[model samples]
Target: MSKMRPSKKELLEGMTPSTVHANEIANVASGELGLEQNDSLTEEEKMRLVCSRFLDIKEDDLMDGDYFFTELDSGKYDEA
Candidate 1:
């Protein structure tokens, strides 16, 4: 079946933050950043390295946290 082309407005609206993030992920997976090959590292380890180095986040700041936040800077994100 032929696919219908999305309208310009629809295409513009579809370029959301998530879609931009996905594109970045795809670029990384495609090795556009000239990442070195490390076959010994597991996927989780590789992700950790990437997040700490490229995302400018410290290793100590990495933690298990909420995926969605109500007020991130107000300290309510970690409230029980």
Candidate 2:
């Protein structure tokens, strides 16, 4: 049996880059213009709405004052 050759997509695999070049590539891949710190929640109401939207429950359930909410931190998404 013969060994299979690498596909065209694999040509750039394992290519090493200096710290500066790596960061430059990352910037191009990320189309966003602002820095990491600039991407944040500035408004209080917006923050509450955004956080609340993540809940899988129905919107009507949220209206009930007696409903107890528990924040579940599962998987690496929280860290991301």
Candidate achieving the largest lDDT:
1
Error of 1 at 68 (Å): 28
After superposing candidate 2 on the true structure, give the runs of residues whose Cα lies further than 4 Å from its correct spot.
Answer: 1-24, 27-38, 43-46, 49-56, 59-80
lDDT for model 1, please: 0.63
Regions of candidate 1 where Cα sits further than 4 Å from its true position: 1-37, 57-80
Number of clashes recorded per candidate: 0, 0
Give the best candidate by TM-score.
1
The per-residue C-alpha lDDT of model 2 at residue 21 equals 63
Lowest lDDT 10-mer window, candidate 2?
A: 65-74
lDDT (Cα, tens digit) per residue for candidate 2, span 1-80:
33465785685576766423656655553436443334554568568868788878777666444333223333433566
TM-score of each: 0.23, 0.21
Candidate 1, run of 10 with poorest lDDT = 30-39
